[model samples]
Target: MSDTTTTSLLDAITVPAAEGRAIPDAATGETMGHAPVHDVEHLNRAVAAARAAQPAWAALGHAERSAILHRTADEIDAHAEELARIIAQEQGKPLNGPGARFEAGGCAAWIRNAADTALDPEVVFEAPGTRSELHYGPLGVVGAIGPWNWPAMIAIWQIAPALRMGNTVVSKPSEYTPLSVLAVAELMNRHLPEGVLTVVSGGRDVGEGIAAHPDIDKVMFTGSTKTGRAIVKSSAGNLARLTLEMGGNDPGIILPGTDVKAIAENLFWGVFINTGQTCAALKRLYVHDSQYEEVVRTLADMAASMPMGPGLDESSVLGPLSTKQQFDIVSSLVEDARSRGARIVTGGEAAPELGPHFYRATVVADIDDGARLVDEEQFGPAIPVIRYTDVDDAVARANASDQGLGASVWGSDVAEAVAVAQRIEAGTVWINQHGTLNPDVPFGGVKGSGYGMEFGREGLKAVSAPKVITV
Candidate 1:
């Protein structure tokens, strides 16, 4: 393999944690690769390099820096296939699964948006000899601690904006899925200056190093709320600027008179797209009692239709969970839901017939608010459905969670659907649809899902040190 040894961080860098670790394909449970568990000593080296690079990168004019970022998009496009393969092997998501290509496309979009729309602070001049200006500048190097879910794509959400704003970065991708980030970093740096972007991989210790680094001017994290809170506490000493995109238990609602069969397709892919291991995947669903049966039947049919296999197989629609812990979590959630008197309408067990690390796309019905599956972020393929007598009740049930990451309200009636959508407490609410993202708009969440936005000018704006000049 072109990547198994050459671009391997183990061969490339020396670290204490790099001693020995096996990287296996999640789909087939085969040892496809290995990578170093980068230690703090290695992390410190990357941080120092980033600190040195940030100043020089920032010294470049905005247009020039933006141009470099734009070029990065082109480089990513050129290397999409290679990156995708690495992502599939290490992360165990399929080659066709949304990996390098999707991520590279997002990088293109974000950098372009940051360079264009996400502006420097506005400059205002009043008629009576009063001048006021707001300008943005990079915050030196940034520390990015990313999760394992969708490694390359989400990491780009941080790296793209930070780079466009001329902030060098030392990002630690989740140890559970480090190969994608390692390959992405290697490929990206080939098109960029050496120290502009660095990827260091390890477990929690490496993450701690990035969070507490004195040279790091800002910190961006995408992971669990528990970890995010700890990051904030650690960042207190340096008071480094922070942005956290945490977990979600996003709701999906179906109202009366809705075309159940038509939406079944969208809902299926939306929830189980990546084995339902998504931040915004439909965890808790509310259906109007009048149409509950139809919706349930439709969803079940759709889930059953999806093809599953080892990633290399063309027939595979769903792959395995990235790690053993996630598999256990999904399995336990199903066992709990079943024990709580929920109906397992479709799937509820590990598909040993499929292979290791594979879990069936589970669906549960007749769930209530108090059920563990109802109000929690499953982050798996299992979805629990609850029926409501009234639209208001459905809306109430949806908004009951402390997490406000994303939500979707569905119906044939646009007016009614949008109205219910307004009542949703999420940061991004879709009408008649589920997950979708672009570089132009701000993306983040409220409450426990964390604070601050990413993507577009909003993301670039976050990396800048806002200065207010008034005369």
Candidate 2:
């Protein structure tokens, strides 16, 4: 009944910081909590703790480590609701809907799945007198840098594999949404031995410190391509094994004969999930010229129908963009498209009536590949519907970007959609659906989207060093 949004639990449980900085709420623009601004010195200590713990932790061997991971997953599942609320409060996502609870559930599931996945020693070659075996050796310490969007899930994506692969972890979550991640780290640490997992909350410099830390043998990061590039540059000093999941200007192609009405809701959520803050969310939608208007009309109507508000509100389907800077970016891109003759099919302006950073789910029609909305990764709730005459040309346009994160093909005929999806240059290409990720499926990027994979056996390998032993 109160007009104010619910506060984060971390706001009450403030860990002392030498130089604390405030983090604002996404919905109200009110300062929700303060996190300690950790510097290189703080990072060094965390990394040292990781180093001190790695050998003993790794010495526990696969079974013991797996048990601990299972216990950690249990802890996560037990605290799901509380954790989800923390996520909603700090990260500006609906608590009950596919927001905080979904993300928290995902974190728990990823850990459980990681525990079940095996990284068994392989005997590569064997003769009567000689044998060679390949084993995955734990890298001393893994440095994880998680982004603000889906902080808990992405942190688990980074940490679960690292820990399961027998490495100690030191994580630095984006300062804006650090609380949920800090809480995750606490839960994980409780289930493990001391110094095995550490979280240092800070800004850009702390992330850079983690990347450049000599003690950290590997760095797993999920963020912007610009920040990914910076991490690559810094990690070069240590020659650390790096898995970077970066930017995506993902495309969704709607084939000529597809039923617009049938797929509208799926299309709407595919592009607009996480308020379009998703790295793999469809940013550009290529519709057949014949179906363009119908597709646009249906999607726009759906977008306009959804309620936008604070995460705590039960009626709200979409929450505010996680930060003011992101809101500005979305606004600027929409404005640029408008200036270039793109029609605002539905919502475009910020909903000040809702709260700060609450930009309505926007749909832009009559946009070309040249439009900013079509080309750039807006990373917000604004989608451009581009009309394409030829299917080949559409695929070409989709592959023309500097990014190749994810792509989707939609058609009434699943086989035809599959055929077209194969042509798009991206890490993962979907048929009928978009951005549906599985714990066992490997996902990453190509071209300027950055390299290396996450999830599955490959993800386990990314956090490990393969050593060949001959006897």
Candidate 3:
């Protein structure tokens, strides 16, 4: 889309307010638009509006709600390009590759899946005279707090199920990328009833209010572990149900004798997708000593070849870091690794020529477990490849982290890979891929990564309360 058209789209959704925050394009640092700065009072008003509208929304029954959800999905499909453009501008993800466009299409697909997934009341217990049926009913208003990494798509992941299960929603988008989410909410509201869905763009106060609001029946949040802990504490007043998808320092293991060349592309995308800002992206790799050199070489070559530039560029698959703060974090981690004698196989520097936030994709080898880059969730365009002599030891090291969001095993022997995957202590374990999600599969984290699941039937249930009736 042209700059004029992009500005027009943002203007259409931008709320006019005396108090607002300027939103900047992630690539160029240009002011894209403004988002109304909502406070706790605005959050309260939004919760009240959602609560007042929820009963009627629930009374519409599953069939009508499902129909409306399907229509909303269609609307999302209609405006997918516009939403993708907004995401590219605000979130620093390229329009091409597995970036803005992929996320936009995912929103529609997930909404449709939520609509079609069967969640009818089921008979849990049956006898001659006694019968019990379990039903899932709306839990009133749902508070959705989304992250900046996948702003629009993750909002849909929270909103779609909540709305599909017959609940009104009040969402708080991350401060860094509120425009992308606001634009999405604008498109969805075209089909949804007034007050049934609201997006309050603000800072930490608004997010805390959403978690602590008494009228809000549940909170769905995706962000950092530190912030997730704060939300957990905030939810204590009313004990609102929470589904938190938090920090993930996922690991990938390459078993002995694996074909490094065949899986190089998948591995590269797994570590570098969205410039590695993804919550579940593979942050560290444990390669067997036999193929460690080959794996490092393959990844470094791929990292050096991918173009890192502005998100709007047609040929740019890799884009800038979403924010300067994130860029600093990634840079610090890599610098620490370099100081500790880790090999910076390809890139270890920033690309200020492209933009203030651009960092070249990096591959670090000869890194061990104690280094900050190997231990922390780097969440940027960098991966540390550690060599291991034994498969069991590798599995043990991968499972040693506090975060257990996702893990992957790569090997020529399918059974061996599956065996290694089974031993990992993570919410989801992939055989040959990493961070690949499907609408039908359940996804979430364990331990410090956060609790509760999101996606498919479990996601539907997470937003609603269950009632058992024995007759």
Candidate 4:
């Protein structure tokens, strides 16, 4: 075990102590607060601290480590309400409703589950003179780079498993949504040993530094493909183990016999949750030609009925995009599709009155596969509905993306839906549902969606190294 040292205020200082970045309220575009912007030096210090603390932390018994993690989770639960409000203000997910609380609750659940998860040593061979056992051991310091879509929950997703496996962590939250994650670190750090867990908030430079750091043994990141590629290149400096959950252009296929009304509400939330910022949200909908019009009209009516306003407003069901950049991405895709003769059944423009980044829930039909909205991930509150005549062709089209993160098939016939789900090429395939993730289930992507599982025992192993012992 390495020597333990007490952490001081200096350990938490950002590189440019006086310079901070303002955090904008996603719903109102108003200044909520400012997060200290760190630099490469701050990130390097965090990695060094984590590296120094990891040996001692991993030296503790698994049960002892688990207890500390549970205590951190308890602290998180105690502050759920306060955390939820802060998260809503910063990330634009509804507070009184399901958005903020769901993320907060998820953090607690995943942390607790990770605490309980353990890999027992396995006996490999038993002979008169020889025996072997397989073990999963910690990989020292882990670097966690979090995303903005579900700031608190995703950060916990990375931190919990790494800590549970007896590794110290240095995490960096997205600059756009750093407050909630910083708050998570502040509360969690109170229950954790000094240098066990640290959060360095900064822009691209800090992220690159962590990935390229010599001391960080593993890297877990959730973000875009472009950035994930860069991290892969930087991590080559030390060949750090990586788990990346990148971009996804998920598809939801509505079979001809599916009951449109029965699934409308679930379908609406499935696609539009978190204002459609979810990586695995149903980005494109492929419907049978017979039900194309019905699906589009039903979805448009359901979308229009839901009110859009500030996330803190109890009546609003949807909030603005988290940033002006995201708003522009969604707007541009919708515009490109609209120009290509795709009919916008409902919304297709920005809601500047609500906020600078507000975009209405949109449904576009009469679109071919060539449309940008249909081919690419809008990553916002816009979905394209493509008409298909043959089931085989629909499945083929759905699996055509460079991304294979998640896909779903909807139909009244349970057997048929499950069978169809088997054909969609994605890491996770859903039948009559979409993006339903649990801690016990392993989830990841294939192809350009990025690699490595994030949950279940497989995820726990991702943070660990396997060693074989012989006797």
Reference-based TM-score of each model: 0.94, 0.95, 0.97, 0.95
Candidate 1: Cα lDDT at 321: 82
Q: Going through the candidates in order, what is the number of backbone clashes in each?
A: 2, 0, 0, 0
Better of 1 and 3 by TM-score: 3
Segments in model 1 whose C-alpha atoms lie over 4 Å from true places: 1-20, 97-101, 104-118
lDDT tens digits by residue: candidate 1, 1-471: 135344543243322334646767777677656666679999899888988877788888688877877777776676677666666655656656453345546555655666665475687765578889888878899999988878888888888788888799898998777877776676567567878898887889988877888888899999999999999988888889999999799999998999886777778877886787778777888988999888888888777777776666655677778788888888888888899999999988888888887888877998789888786788887889889998888888888898999999889999999988999899899877787777777889998899998877678888888887887
Q: Give the lowest summed-lDDT range of ten residues in model 1.
A: 8-17
lDDT of 2 by residue, 153-177 (tens): 9999999988987899999999889
Instruction: Report the C-alpha displacement of residue 208, candidate 4, in angstroms.
Output: 0.8
lDDT of 4 by residue, 205-279 (tens): 889888999889999999999999999999998999999999799999999889998888778888999889998
Tell me the RMSD of model 3 versus the true structure. 2.3
**lDDT at residue 373 of model 3 (Cα atoms):** 98
Per lDDT, the best of the predicted structures is 3
Residues 350-424 of candidate 3: C-alpha lDDT, one tens digit per residue: 998999999999999999999999999999999999999988899999999999999999989999899888899
Q: Candidate 3 at residue 16, lDDT?
A: 56
Give the per-residue Cα lDDT of candidate 4 at 212: 90
In terms of TM-score, the best-performing candidate is 3
Question: Which residue pairs clash within candidate 3?
Answer: none
